[model samples]
Target: MSESVAPVSRRGFLAGATALGAPAPAVPAVAQPRAGIVILIDRNDPHVMGHAISYSGNLSRYFTGKGQAVPPIEVVANGLGIDVFRADKSPLKEPLATLRQMIPTVVFSMCASSKSIAESRENLTIQLIDGARLVPFGIGRMVELQRKGWAYVHG
Candidate 1:
């Protein structure tokens, strides 16, 4: 007589493995980062800002779909990128607002140096959209965030 074994169902296999102390699956750090991420935008293009927003939103969706908490995300703008956050001139106001609504923890920051230069060149006070903050130096902020273990993405 030949020996025979019954097929195991997925659930049964999992249960058997668990009983044997098998480790549970782990999600990647990027999917549910503990230290969060920083998105850098250094251009004066609306397209780049839109793309950064989309990328941030996608990151949010990725982790949330898996029932994971979104890590803190900061979109840091420098140089001509400062214009993207202008309250009066930006064409991406709606998209930026939408991204904020989706990820309340997401932050928008502009470089003070850039803003000052733009103001001097244009001879007008540049007001950032509500909730957008100004950092002393964009590069410094990036480095600080990195020092704290936050992931950086150039958008």
Candidate 2:
């Protein structure tokens, strides 16, 4: 004798689970309309820069794919994170330049204070990537963006 197995539908399973007091699965939050987004990177590691770049690219793609306009994105690098913007020391120069070209609305900002400090401490001249802008202060820039209703992400 073969044992018969009952087929379970998705609706049945969910209803049964709910009836058993099992919590419902969470749904992802919908994207909110915003002026723009700013990403803050304060680490000196190349990995941090890579993550920032990847996240920025993904956000841009997500909005465009969803038929929504992509918002302006800015990556503000300060503290040790400023190293990722240095042409001579950074392994990300080429990739940064390419990303700048590929994403028109994405911009990279390097902190002037951090560059000065690094130059004095490390005794090395720092050259930023072609499209990177020199901001007076990375933290200040982030604050400014936040005040303007831009979403902030720490990477």
State which candidate has the highest TM-score.
1
Full-model lDDT, candidate 1: 0.90
1-155 in candidate 2: lDDT tens per residue?
99998999877888888899998666579675567989998998878889888888889889989999889999999999997788877778777777777797688899999999999998987888777889999999999889888999988
Show model 2 residue runs off by greater than 4 Å: 1-34
**lDDT for each residue of candidate 1 in 1-155, tens digit (9 for 90 to 100):** 99899999877887888899997555357553368899999998878888898999999999999999988999999998887899978888888998889898899999999999999999999999977999999999999999888999988
* Prediction 2 global C-alpha lDDT: 0.87
Q: lDDT scores for all predictions?
A: 0.90, 0.87
**Count of backbone clashes for each model?**
0, 0
Error of 1 at 89 (Å): 1.6
RMSD each, Å: 12.1, 11.8
